[model samples]
Target: MMNSRNFLDLEEVRMEVFSGKISRAYCYVLVKQGKIKAIRVGRKILIPVNEAARLLAEGVN
Candidate 1:
């Protein structure tokens, strides 16, 4: 289980990481491709802040 404080939703990732340039579907693709790590809680997918930061630092391929 992830602490909410350390996680961001896909929407936040889309907006903050990709600056809303990427679609929500693309975020799912990253997860599926193992590019981003995520956990599914019920129907909600939670992405760790560190993962987002890593993506920012590493840039998306």
Candidate 2:
């Protein structure tokens, strides 16, 4: 099981990763496109911190 601390919500991703440049809708699109790996908990989308790091390392296209 993965700890909740290892995940980030779309808002955090936008703020921390993109510096608030991207919207949540765009993040959702990335999730739908498989560019960002996410797990759904109820209605909340949780993205793995490592995945965010990978995106940072690889650069989003």
Candidate 3:
């Protein structure tokens, strides 16, 4: 059900992707680092599927 257009919640990414070690603030850090893209909708930040893939790929390094 996940597509390139889908946006992931920051909290979900923190738990699922980073395994609870990364905080939401650090998610913003990734954005700042240009490792991912954050879409700000109101007060929440969302990660697109492609950007999430980029972050996951970064773990290989």
Candidate 4:
């Protein structure tokens, strides 16, 4: 199982957390909006598992 300490890529977030309802562009927006905690590792954007869960539970609305 995934945990807070683990980091997930944007695609993983879309596939697993958001269920692909949101696009990569929106995911970038979410990171920019500061709704979710994330970091850039080279060309990839990664989010913490717990933060992703929090964002889902809270919703972007």
Candidate 5:
């Protein structure tokens, strides 16, 4: 079973949360700046769906 705290891969994250267009460089910056959340599982960066949603909402407000 998938864990509750699992995160989505960058491509999936971009396609879904970013409306199918987001820069790779910008994502790295966000990760470095900690504006968005990221978890390192092995060699990949993943962002949780809920966290991404919350961040997007926070931006609008």
Candidate 6:
């Protein structure tokens, strides 16, 4: 399967990623916890493009 599709660094994700509203460290923790899907490219983390929406709609899976 193809990995790393075009993901929006959207405002909400940015807020969560940048502002400590959610905390980037926490996001990575979720990935490690298998709460959300993710992959690392070298030193960078990539969250799935649909992650925020999926989280909003379904939550924590």
RMSD of each: 3.6, 3.6, 2.8, 2.0, 3.7, 5.8
lDDT, candidates in the order shown: 0.86, 0.83, 0.73, 0.81, 0.70, 0.60
Task: Give, for candidate 1, the lowest lDDT window spanning 10 residues.
Answer: 1-10
- Per-model TM against the reference: 0.86, 0.84, 0.69, 0.80, 0.70, 0.58
* Global fold similarity of model 6 (TM-score): 0.58
- lDDT tens digits, residues 1-61, model 2? 2255899888888788888898889889988898888899999999888988887788676
lDDT of 5 by residue, 1-61 (tens): 1356567786666666677566877777777788878888898998887777776567412
> TM-score for model 2?
0.84
What is candidate 3's lDDT per residue for 1-61, written digit by digit as tens? Answer: 1554588887877776788797778777877776667788998888877666776767623
Off by over 4 Å in 2: 1-4
Q: Which residue pairs in candidate 4 have backbone atoms (N, alpha carbon, C) closer than 3 angstroms, thus clashing?
A: none
lDDT of 5 at 57: 68
Q: Model 1: how far is 39 from its true place, Å? A: 0.8
Question: Which parts of model 6 are misplaced by more than 4 Å?
Answer: 1-5, 8-20
Error of 3 at 60 (Å): 9.8
Whichever of 2 and 5 has more lDDT, that candidate is 2
**Which prediction has more favorable lDDT, 2 or 4?**
2
Writing each residue's lDDT as its tens digit, candidate 1 over 13-49 gives 8898889998889889988898889999999999888
Worst 10 residues of 5 by lDDT: 52-61
Strongest candidate by TM-score: 1
Stretches of model 3 off by over 4 angstroms after superposition: 1-5
Across 1-61, the per-residue lDDT of candidate 4 in tens digits comes to: 2654588888888888888898889889988988777999998899888877876788765
**Model 1: CA > 4 A from native:** 1-4
Q: How accurate locally is residue 5 in candidate 5, as Cα lDDT from 0 to 100? A: 57
Model 5 per-residue lDDT at 40: 84
